[model samples]
Target: MQNGTVSMAELLNSSSALIFMGTGCSSAVPNAMCLIQPSDPPCSVCSQSLSIPPDLNPNYRGNTSLLIDHLQSNGEHSYILIDVGKTFREAALRWFTFHKIPRVDSVILTHEHADAVLGLDDIRAVQPFSPTNDISPTPIYLTEDSMNSVGVKFPYLVQKKLKEGQEVRRVSQLDWRIIESHHEKPFVASGLQFFPLPVMHGEDYVSLGFLFGETSKVAYISDISRFIPSTLSVISKSGGGQLDLLIIDTLYKTGSHNTHFCFPQTLDAVKTICPKRALLVGMTHEFDHHKDNEFLTEWSKREGIPVQLARDGLRVPIDL
Candidate 1:
């Protein structure tokens, strides 16, 4: 078994990470309850490291709702939400309703696909305090190619306009952070180190995986069709067994899928990455929680690894 010892940092630097392992594909979100909740006040399982946000408008229907929450707490607690899928409005409302997320300081885009970035406008929920308070725009990070895609999708955000006495827009006007990179470039934004994992999505130059934070790290790879050799090297090099959690897309079951990781393929990745914990996300109606729980429980016991089947409202903490 891997070492069970935990590391302690001096002065207790404000560093913490959270993984919201749930399905984000297009399926109705399934309600889930704590499997490990206790029968008492201030319940432990009820108040796990992760909490599901409340439903605001209550009109969220598309794909499965598997949101990812990667947070860091050293000096000030910072949070990053990767891959705001088509259901971003719902996802944002759910997140804000459930947790005390201070503010979405910044956002990092994985790709320009609708499923990955359709939620770009959801940041309106966290603007500065006002009745009609014009809140500052939050910084969003993305590569040049992805930025082009964003400009195409959301033309209003990137289109330049000639305003008298305004050659450049003020920081508060636009919620953007242009990241100069393509797939596989080591890009840093908002005190977060992001390594874009080069992936194949059926010859389409879309989709990206990310490794976030500094000392302790979390890796997120969703909407990935194939994990190429070079990207594997980057992940292996940057991983350093310092990975507390790794989240990946496991869309299909055991069948062969051309553009995504099947069950066996995801298993192989787990064997390769060997994270302290591995969570399979992007589930669908085909993959039932009740059945997956049984399968994963047996699989974990046999494989001697901690493997979890992510649900719509489950939270996994990564703090050392």
Candidate 2:
């Protein structure tokens, strides 16, 4: 498994980067519950999400998603997407235009939840081009259990025969590859290697985090209530125990949830992993981005590790 770790020399270009497609929880920042219901005082975060010059609005988020623009040797780009959720179309309309992303080369699913997999039907939007979609089927990597859930939820996506009568329709042409669990070996996607880190979402359900990149090792666990021992071991053992970046789940400011990391749990995990830099994601409308980020900046100084919040359209360069 530790055969060939990418060397620092390979990262001199330093052009590769990760773009946050969406950084909000399932409902997003200004969801219907918050907007339509309109609490007496009105949700401050949801209210501010519609501020003028929306590009600068951190609160306007879609479901948590990550796009890795891996720069290839021939000056080409490989776009590997992680989690196309319930708000995939909306996120795409805004982010794809803002970032000028031409296409999505591959997809990786962390779990089977609606926040992670509902966007499967929309993959056709970026397979090759907009209207034609005449390229090869995009490869999607996911665990067997998650794939089972997908098969149950999206039977036609897994098997074309299920939609035999609907062959005329141009559904998302996808290639499903059932991968093993976190304990299994690493897999390659679009020339980049990724190691799955299995984590507990709730008591019975499990989701995946991923560790990827060459010199700039980044560990991204977008949804997790707890980190498993085996997963922690892999994180510490890899790259001689030095992780460049960690993007983790921080569902709320305080209080614990059964399926996601809260503020205190996020602090604990950050202390353990001790990455050079950490960015929190999967937030609800409860957090004020500027306020929380300001607090986190001071906290990062105290902890000696730069930590902050990730918002939709935020991009961070990484050495690849």
Candidate 3:
């Protein structure tokens, strides 16, 4: 059995959780214009980082998405993707292509936001590599409301009938499965059971976090503004009252966001869950990789909790 910590290569080779992308808000790091010329008064993070070569600094990031890999007994692998945002293509090219992750077994969406579902069309790129000769569609799990939103966003893919005499265009291959976000029912996907932890996105929106695994439960909440007491109760009752790993949203260091969690809110949620280890996700350009790591190291020492900022290619093995 594996002990201590594992590397990204080892984690991807076995059953593990991989953070494919870690930026929370829409635009990715190292903004194009910022690279062209420094901000007026000089934005500390972007301006200074851009002055250095990308190969040297490497601070660019993509949208938040997680990949849960399950290694079958027969030596085959199944990959369940969580959230396919607009940056999915870029992230795939940067990470998945080199890793040889050709086909996705399933997908679980948190909500209907553009940053969470815009990459739905990009799944077509993997169709040619499907194992089955018939090219079976990948199943997607999401709430009914989210499903409706997806349908409206991609009508050509959702609707069976197209305009009369219009040729069928090659599109994303997918099967939509509506899942209830009641926090009581658990659903199976990619040969693993996932328990949904419903949380509030803001005053109006509702988003979902997930709890998975038997011996070592890993809770993933990529986007959330707040968590209700009932959700906290469910999480507290999981993994023997504490999470093994908690992946949460940290959109920014300061300021109050209406639909995303900032650093303070993320810390509050982490305090409630009290996970053994936590990784902050959904970050923006405000978070510099090297600088943030130093800050998190000090914070972790003070709080006595192992917490760090997640990067685009971070892979952590979940002990089961």
Tell me the lDDT of candidate 1.
Answer: 0.59
Per lDDT, the best of the predicted structures is 2
lDDT digits (tens) for residues 38-75 of candidate 2: 88899888877556455778988789999998987777
Model 3's TM-score against the true structure: 0.88
**Backbone steric clashes in candidate 1, count:** 19
For residues 248-312, what per-residue lDDT tens digits would candidate 3 score against the true structure?
Answer: 99888898799889998888777767888898888887888788889989988988788988777
Q: What is the C-alpha lDDT of each candidate?
A: 0.59, 0.85, 0.78
Flag regions of model 3 displaced more than 4 Å: 1-12, 47-58, 73-75, 129-134, 237-240
lDDT tens readout by residue for model 1, 55-136: 3211112333333334334355566666566666665555555654556666777767777666665555555654432456
Comparison by TM-score, 1 against 3, better one: 3
Q: Rank the candidates by lDDT, best first.
A: 2, 3, 1
- The superposed Cα distance between candidate 1 and the true structure at residue 239, in angstroms, equals 8.3
Question: What's the TM-score of each model vs. the native?
Answer: 0.73, 0.90, 0.88
Candidate 2, superposed: residue stretches over 4 Å from native:
1-14, 129-134, 162-167, 237-240
Model 1 worst lDDT window (10 residues) = 56-65
